[model samples]
Target: MKTNIKILALFLICSISAFAQSSKDAETVLQLSKDKWQWMADKNVDKLKDLFDAKAKFVHMSGTWKTDEELEIIKTGSIWYKEAKVHDSAIEVSGKTAIVWNRITLIAMVRGNEAKTEFTVTEVYQKQKKDWKMLALTFSSVRDTHQIKK
Candidate 1:
């Protein structure tokens, strides 16, 4: 019937719209990941605290820490990020979960020692009540590909 055909067409349109919306959301999450790095570099613990989930876990070359502990470290400048240069990044979203990957060159002060290193960072964020909060983060050291040729 023509009515049945019309209903099917409308359903297809709605499905496509939903898919586009999800794609847009994924892009937003990727940008948020970049913003997070900027926040860390600036040592904006207040903003970082708002973005991190209460049950979040952070892992680095040194060790792992919970959300509150990580926030405290940032606030006190124990391991302060001075700069982060992102070399490459990607993001994927599945329902309310998003995973972001970034290859970055980071300069930071770790326990009063200035160190610069390259790392591949993975961040997992979950959508919580219309906002995305970071749930977990892990980083692995990488070779510096950003070195200038003399």
Candidate 2:
């Protein structure tokens, strides 16, 4: 009975440690998301290449594409992010995967046309070795509060 109690206690300790680690990872991933936005605004394709998983999928209001394609677009100055003002965000971590929801106001240029819009972006990240790589990103356009009918 003593041995069984020790084993159970060990298991509980391990579980708690994992939860703490996951919380830390979530915070790191959240900060990485913010850094990614800064990179996008700066058009830093090289840095983006390191952050994004090779198999990453990027979905936007305009279109969807793989990591390589998105890099190409950014490299060619096709879609330029001028600013990303995050209003709120939330993060959830599950083992090796982390999901972040960010509500933001974006100022950008698409095909040389300036656009200012609000979006709720869902970003998925996966732990790889010692680093986290972005696996998927999806954006949904949000209506402005002023635009809602009272």
Candidate 3:
């Protein structure tokens, strides 16, 4: 009975430690997301590419899906960010796979025009070998003017 109890205690400890590590990793990725936005604002396309998985997919709110190269164009100075703020976010992990949900507001320069937008973004990250890479992202945007007044 004592041996069984010890084994159970060890299992619990290992489980808790894993949960803590996963949360920490998720937080790091979340912060990375913010940093990636900053990189985009600066038009650092090379760095942006590093942030994505080689097989990454990005889905725009308008139902347009893009490859990593296509997404990098935005980071290459095609658009500029006047304001971008991450609102709410959550993470779920299973083994090497992590799914992150992030809510954000963005004011950007697009096609020589300025626009403010809100979005709910879901990103899937995979642990590739020794590093985490963003594999897929899907987001739906809400026009700022259409949002309810608080």
lDDT of each: 0.89, 0.91, 0.74
C-alpha TM-scores of all predictions: 0.88, 0.90, 0.83
Model 1 Cα lDDT, one tens digit per residue, 25-103: 7888888888998899888988898899999999999899999999999888999988888888878788899988888
Q: Give candidate 3 regions above 4 Å deviation.
A: 63-65, 143-150
Model 3, 34-139: lDDT tens digits are 7876876777777767778877888764454455554655755455766668776777778888887777797788768887889877788888887788888776
Model 1 weakest lDDT span, ten residues long: 141-150
State how far residue 16 of model 3 sits from its true place (Å). Answer: 2.0
Query: Rank by TM-score, descending?
Result: 2, 1, 3
Considering every candidate listed, which one attains the maximal TM-score? 2
Error of 2 at 132 (Å): 0.9
lDDT preference between candidates 2 and 3, better one: 2
**TM-score of candidate 1 to 2 decimals:** 0.88
Which segments of model 2 are wrong by more than 4 Å? 145-150
Worst 10 contiguous positions by lDDT, candidate 2: 141-150
